[model samples]
Target: MRLAWFSWLVRNFGGYGFSDGPLRAAIGAGAVLLTAFLVRITLHRHRPAAVAAAGLTCALGFGWLAFH
Candidate 1:
């Protein structure tokens, strides 16, 4: 099952292996920061932004590759 792999991933891989791992945590943190930054700069709520999310995905992808 998927849960089995996830649990194994967590057990072997450190914090990043968890569902709320540092990689994703970083992503979420980045997104929130990006959103706030956008609001401050644009003063708009509907403004679209993908900077933080992209950075997060790249970081996590690299890290996963490195470990594997």
Candidate 2:
């Protein structure tokens, strides 16, 4: 289940861009990081832990994809 989601994320990393190699990798990492940062900052105060968890998940996913 987790492998499926990870592969999906990796597949989409190059789905919409005219980039390749390190450029594509950088773009993918930036997209994930920025989206996670926005979510972390915009969540309700009552869900602080959820926001942090989501951010950490995204960061880890980015790192994994960046080096995978």
Candidate 3:
């Protein structure tokens, strides 16, 4: 799963109209890091229901991204 996510990142780097590869990669990495940090905090502080909701939200987000 981790490898696939990294592969997707690499394949989609500079996909948002950014011409510089390194800058795009950095932005992507930062976004992933920020998401991880937020999820970690949510898991630590929130209830299981909240965690499940977060996971579901992420899945729906990825599904939207995949299909559209």
Candidate 4:
């Protein structure tokens, strides 16, 4: 089932599915960033380090997964 869905995505999309992986990763990273933003807002503290750490972590993870 999962394979079928992925195949469909690859067929309907373009570039031999290369774009699909990054697109999905970007979406997931966006969600994580949004969650981090919400957490920072709820805490009511100017935690720049935390935000930067989260952003960097997400970017590294996305890069690793999307490029690996």
Tell me, by TM-score, which candidate is best.
Answer: 2
Q: How many residue pairs clash in all the candidates, one count each? A: 0, 0, 0, 0
**Runs off by more than 4 Å, candidate 1:** 1-19, 44-68
**What lDDT does each candidate get?**
0.56, 0.70, 0.58, 0.63
lDDT of 3 by residue, 20-46 (tens): 556654565456456645775677766
Query: Who is ahead in TM-score, 2 or 3?
Result: 2
Query: How many pairs of residues collide in model 2?
Result: 0
The sequence of per-residue lDDT tens digits that candidate 2 reaches over residues 1-68 is: 99998888778766534235767667777778787777676675748776887678796776666565
lDDT of 2 at 60: 78
Q: What residue runs in model 4 are displaced by over 4 Å at the alpha carbon?
A: 1-20, 45-68
- Every model: Cα RMSD to truth: 7.7, 7.7, 5.2, 9.7
| TM-score attained by model 4 | 0.39
Better of 2 and 3 by lDDT: 2
Residue-level lDDT for 50 in candidate 1: 47
Question: Which candidate do you rate higher for TM-score, 1 or 4?
Answer: 4
User: What C-alpha lDDT, on a 0 to 100 scale, does residue 8 get in candidate 2?
Assistant: 83
Q: List clashing residue pairs in candidate 1.
A: none
What clash pairs does model 4 have? none
